[model samples]
Target: MNLRQLIDASEGVVKADRVITGGTLVNVCTGEVYPADVAITGDRIAATGDVTAYIGEHTEIVDATGKHLVPGLIDGHLHLECSKLSPTMFADAVVRYGTTSVISGLDQILVVAGVDGVREALREAEQSPMKIFWGAPFKTPYTLPETTVGFNFGPAEHEETQDWADCYGVWETVAEFVLNRDPDVLRALELAHRNRLPVFGCAPMASSTTINALSAAGIRLDHESYTAEEALEKLRAGMYLLIRESSVAHFLNENVKTVTKFGAQSRRVGFCTDDMHVADILREGHLDKLVRMAIQAGVKPIEAIQMATVNCAEMYRIDHLVGSITPGRYADVLIIDSPESFQVERVFSRGVLAAENGRTVTAPAAPERSAALSPAFQVPELAASAIGIAAAGDSAEVLVVEMDRTVPFVRTRLDLTLPVKGGVVRADVAQDALYCTVSERYGKTGATATAMINGFGLRSGAIASSAAPDDNNIVCVGANREDMALAVNHLAAAGGGQIVVENGEIKEFLPLPVAGIVADIVPEEMAAAEDRLEAAARALGCELPSAFGYLIFLEITAIPDYAVTDLGVISYHTQSVVDTVLTSR
Candidate 1:
């Protein structure tokens, strides 16, 4: 079938604007290789065949010699926020890597999606060749208390505070104002559906009913399961599963039985990198590593590919445009020497050459410079007296942090009594681990309350990370209270970034101006910065996870034990929030 002749013969079947030839097609339909040509029209696959009879004078032709044509690789689940890049830059980078589509991770909710940010991202994504979809943010900085909580504050109270939105007003409004009054959840769902994008979210294990309700409301998938049992329940109840890299890795280390038990299910399952760090991506790989991990867990290679590609496209309703290289599917494909190895020979996106010999052909725009550092990270000037603790005796019993090895929820009241420094109960680091604090960076500046934590092998010094999306507050973790104070003071001096401080001196620092959390730098630069930071941590005698492991603790969604946000110390297991000032003492 020549390009013009194929178009003319199947006028109703296709309206191609361009044609591509000279590539082998990855027939995902049968998991085989074959030769074919493909034509595309206005972001959709028109027709595909030999296309020798369809050649036309006006049709733009791409000679994809020595390349493979298949459907664009689909990232089943990923958070653009993790890249810390804007939508355009993220799309540009991933497009060059042969990813034509991605399901935007739940980060939209935490950053700005509720304020029409999602629509804006979608609009910008359409300007590029790659496709973008988003999952709505469903978790709350506060819990859903009742169906009808009154917004009792009068106009006078509103005028008295600017901290309203960042701390409590916005959340209250979403509950009592937006979600409670307007049923805006349904409206948001409808808006996404109208725009033809996939909508998925976080559903905790305890909230099965809400999951059912979300499914009823048109949410098609979830990515927050901690166990195979939880995943199986959702699958049986009609929700597709997106196994995140962290969650899967955690569970596998705990016990691989569940995965070995249910690893082969063809439907209702897919892979997601979720919140992968740049260092991990560079050292490992993206979805390539995810697929490999699944296959190692006993999943079949073809089934893993289907989960990564076809199953994901089906959930997002883009299967017609991608997920296979059939007669009418786009020739976005990958050719490799071995399916199990995932070694790339050549790659195609929309039937056009994108990458060859394991390197990107396109250069995405450089990321924009970050905003100047904020003074909010500076520690308050205080005498040693300010770090005071009060208890009935020399030792005080407290709720020690008990983190679920897999899920984000932490168990509280695992009691530990430690030496009281100056009257303040403190972490017993020599026993193994201690606690840290992460003040929410989206609001007014405030110190996060300190709590007991374990797992990071820190003997001394402080480690700080931030989720300071818009606000400038720095989140800090330390075994030594004096080091915590000194690190914050130093950050005040150096601007914003991850810093490791020991005995009142800065050992290593990675300045991240983007949201006071991410760096403006690329993966390689960020990776180098992380290496330095890790060395600093090891110099202080800490080694278990990377120095960036504290980064995971700053995120409220994944950490289950007591966590410090701008709101104070919140017990995710108990749904109780205590004032930081009161809790630390």
Candidate 2:
């Protein structure tokens, strides 16, 4: 049936603006692969049949010779901010990979910092070819008991959120901080529904009471599951589980026996690359890698695909648009060479050749830099004097916290007695350890906490980074006190960048002029620079936490706890924010 004849026959019933000729359709709805011609009128698919029978002049035709058509791919959950690329660039990069849609969870960190920045991201998102569905960020961000560092929760202005609520009606109810079962947070969830945003909760609350409230309040998705038990409990409680790549990787590596038990229940779960850097994305692939890993770890391919596709679509209530290659769904499909290998031969997004043989066909233009997104770098009063040691005699015994490799928390504390040099406790590099300090970078106060951590491998140097998005005063820490001082100065010298100091001099640096936190450079360049930072840290004898820089955001009260921010070290276990430097040492 030619599309025109079909449209003409259904003229009083259904109409199509365009038609595609001779395409193999993978009907996800029926699990059938058959020959059919597809007709599109505007963005929606109008009809599918043997279109040659009803050809007509008004229809725009695309010859899908020997091509297979499927629905566009959806990224269930992601944080576009960590990509370092603005939303436009991000859309451009992923569209080629067949990602037509993304559920931007917790993305408001980039938007909530400022109204102007939020507007810019939204403007770019609106203009982009790929669909960008945003989740409204709840839970006041970067708000500690005493500090309002980085981007404080700018007032929830209606401009960025109103469209999603009033128009599309998708919203997110995020719970910040250690899940202390705050009823107010539940109230915020109710408010999200009131405002018309479908609520999605951030996982790992300390109390099940909060989880129950969120579930009862109708917040139905979670992405942070540190253990399998937590993942299962949430699923039973009716919250959609968006399992993160790293967390899954960690759990699978531990030889945990329960993954197989949960693998059968994978339908309730979806995949996400929550916080994947661009370099890693280029080298390792995106959610595809997570899918591949799951398959390799004994998950059935059908189940794995469901986690990446149908499950995701159902969770976000976008099943009608994509997730399956049903007759009516948009033709967004990947032509994989082999079902077993999952080697993508070509990709079609929105019925167009977005990627072929392994690269993007169209790239999105970079977003214009907003002055509000960039922070003003403040030269903190950090000198050699600021890096201090507490001791009564010529020798000092210090407690150095040992960080675990697989997790985001410290494992044990190391007690070491070392000689005091020039009235300061000196780091013993021969022992492959050193002193570290976390400074309050918000310019609220000159408060700094000096502590010790092992496994940086540096004998006489320091490395420092920060997540303070506003004042640009980096919360830096180092092994060598003098080198620590030099590192911050080096960062300031470069107008706000990450730096490694060795023996009182700058050893390695990546100039992050954007917000004094994210890189202004391209993803590959930033990845190379990050690699250099890791190499430099390892060369300095650090081996504890390889992704150490990520630690800066953990301490903020709004995110899950056991983290160090510019405010102070917080023990979510005790529900108390503690000093970086302990007096007992």
Candidate 3:
């Protein structure tokens, strides 16, 4: 917007293009509510008050009587690719729920297509009604050489990305690097510090001392706190705490106690869904859902709104652009029924009416598929023998990665004996010990590693995913080798996707042909396909809450205990490869 026009509109010398009158404004900046009229000139909020003199012949007047005007909600941190939808589709899914802005590192796509892919995604984001701010991805593979990725983001990449117009901060500095003071990470952190950018952190279950170390490393924000104590420790260490509520991990209820019990201030706390499925976003609301849950958990209504809006913007250092219904800011406002219910009646993004009554007014056109985001699968054809674990004797004692049923992301190492037949270690279905494998798909090496995992509860089928976290390898788990091989091969043939196979037949498949991570479909179509995949998995005797959820995280090396990569089963605690079979006798 032109500075002179904005000034004239605010001074009433020129008429505002639009005016929202007769609403009780929820002032998130001051925690106060009062009657106000918002005047918009171009895409910025020109003024807020009576605004009687700003009315003219062409002025568009929006009557917000009996409504509460609020700043559009912002998600402090998230991975847009995890929604399994394109940027336009994801924006359509969340804009109706009052979320007008999101911050992401584009780390998933970066892993597959490198820096060029990130640039493609940013160009696509421009077509959406919602604002997308990017962070320079700090770590691409996210760990040691055990994890494979197409790109290795480091100081050079950071320097290039930090100069982008939309780049806000450095994204997700993992705890292992910060704690160990890795030289490459330190150099990246130094560049971020020199550029006056904040560094996002990933330190799950960190102690107070570790938190102190992280704070001293210039890390200013974290979203992995699963408990109220962890949240409070980050707060006391001068770090912003982003309470996460994702599809696989629900830590909001437990972490919100920092405010309800310990009386920690809400300014340093915000809301983020680190990763969410498209179906979940459709079923449950987006940031609007977080606001309601926080209010229901004994937080003040206004404070919950603050956490969803201003707190998040302040945490990312973008408060000057968004997070409040103040002058000199973008005119992104929400008309809600009331503060207690927080039901969004209408959404205005940059002074344009974007959505109303839980639906976007106009759906954004999907961007043309970019070549950079095309299918990334490069694995060789596989056979049942390729996925089998060979044994030298009749029986073998193996180290199994046990999935914790309560916490889907947490895995525990287990040692158990299993019978061998046909010189192959058979999965003991009765004990729920299933076979798991991670196959290299980047074509750097035709490698596949097999391991045993318990508590998946798959009785007679196999599930495979090419969207494995950190490294987008093809990870498969199954009751038998035949089904596992079928599932893996089917996924690669389809380019990239998640699939379930039963009795050597393909039961369900959800294609994610974009860099093996995102689907170029509408939100409704993506959600329905996910629902069908979940049902197919359930029909195959899978007992997890979300079968694909478990499939995607199988190769995530950042988590604790044990994880499967293309190299083998890795012990996160030891940072070394663990033998899948302990003894054969």
TM-score of each: 0.76, 0.81, 0.98
How far out, in Å, is residue 433 in model 2? Answer: 4.4
lDDT of 1 by residue, 1-585 (tens): 456644553453444556777766666567666677776554445666766445565667877676665556678767655554455555544554456677653232234222233344455566555666544433222232211011122223223321221211111112211223334444544555564545565554525665556566555676666667777666766767777664223443222223458553565566665555555565666666666666787776666667678778776666765787654555566655445655555566655556666555665444333222122333454232343334545676665555444343343435666777656776787764465654433333434455666655578888775433222245566678788777655555454567888887888877655434444455566667767887887777675555555444443422354554444456655545643323332
Return the top candidate by TM-score: 3
Put down candidate 3 lDDT per residue, 542-571, tens digits, no spaces: 878898887788787677878888888888
Can you give the lDDT of residue 4 in candidate 2? 63
Span of 10 residues, lowest total lDDT, candidate 3? 143-152
The parts of candidate 3 lying over 4 Å away from their true place are: 2-5
lDDT of 3: 0.88
Comparing 1 with 3 on TM-score, the higher-scoring candidate is 3
Error of 2 at 373 (Å): 2.1
Clash counts for all predictions = 27, 26, 0
Residue pairs in candidate 3 whose N, alpha carbon or C atoms collide under 3 angstroms: none
